[model samples]
Target: MEKRNKILNIEQIHTYYGVSHVIQGLSMYIEEQETVSILGRNGVGKTTTLRSIMGLTPPQSGTINIDGIDTSRWQPHKISKIGVAYVPAERHIFPGLTVEENLKLAARPGNGKDAWTFERVCDHFPVLAERTNQDGATLSGGEQQMLAISRALISNPRIIIMDEPSQGLSPLLVQMITDVVLKFCIKSGITMLIVEQNYRMALKVATRHYLMDTKGEIVKVASTRELVDDPEIIQSHLSV
Candidate 1:
């Protein structure tokens, strides 16, 4: 088999919030076009891991490389400019702007070959298209989540970092988000690093899973199929 290039690499990263030590020597890598997930209970630094990668909270030590460039110290906008898009748990859309405006404002010009155009994003997310003129604050939670993802896609990112994409939604909406990831992202060859509390939804979209311990260390890394078959592993690491 051919070896795939590493699109994102995190080596021995330690992050802190003021005096609170969060991530402790965490290291992981995602190969090109692979959808990898970090799964753990609440407050396990899964979101911190994504934030560290995107330079939202730069690791005090260690290194992060994106597309062969060292981005450990880069600012958030600089990181985004280099083809990394982040969808946070907050769903931070501009409440005053229409859905179409939100997507348009996030778009960046892509290389002609694989560019994700406004029309293309709307096509993939038809609900966003239907609500083009609606203000972001007026949309339902699921619609807001869809808009968030659509905004990320509009930026034409090579990799997308999603933190808890399935949180606080109906089961039907969770399934819809899963389908969007599988059908639109996976098929489009977009590399995704997802931090999810919903293990079932994460398993449905990701090929590999990394389970984090309470101290913010990776305790287990396994193929999704292997982990799925071993209820003991899931129970031991992820169960409440």
Candidate 2:
């Protein structure tokens, strides 16, 4: 049997927002080329888990390892240097800048021939190519989401972490975004750790799912087959 390479690992993380306890002893991991999703009702520390992994909100305890190196004490930029990229839910593009400017601003030269070059990413997202001169904030919600995701890919990360890629989009747009992510997982083999409210979309793209409860801990873990075979799991934990 082939060995699995862990791209990201979290063990017993506890994070807090000004003494308000959250992310109590949450632990999870993603292997290389794996796509994992964390699902739950709102305000259940899903985003906080992603934040903890990225070093945005450092865990008060436990360890975070990326590519086998402990990064619990690293800064967000330092984490990015070690091949972790993030596409936050807010779609934080510079409103005053053009699409081209935004991509260039976040660009870190990737590896080798198949690396995600400016032309390559633009080719992957022709809508962005056509609107290169347009200010980021002026674009429609779907377009902005595309730009946000493109920014992450252009960095050519070992793993990409996304928070609510489907939030605030229409059903049609949500499906479109889902298709984009599915393609990334199939073609690029990019590892992903996603926190999403749209479990249907998440399940479609993720090979594994984590069911987080109100207490900020993982109560259940399932493979796509396991969860699909047992709809009751979704209904019991994920349903509102």
Flag regions of model 2 displaced more than 4 Å: none
| Candidate 2 lDDT, 100-203, residue by residue in tens | 99998888887787778679878888889999999999999999999998888888888989999999999999998998888754468789988888888988
TM per model?
Answer: 0.97, 0.97
Q: Given candidate 2, what's the lDDT at residue 115?
A: 78
Candidate 1 local lDDT, residue 63: 92
How would you encode candidate 1's per-residue C-alpha lDDT over 1-240 as one tens digit per residue? 999999988889899999888999998999999999999998999989988998999999989989888899999999998889999999998989999899999999877766877898887788888989999889998999888988888898899999999999999999999888888778878899899989999889999999999888898999999987987898899888
TM-score of 1: 0.97
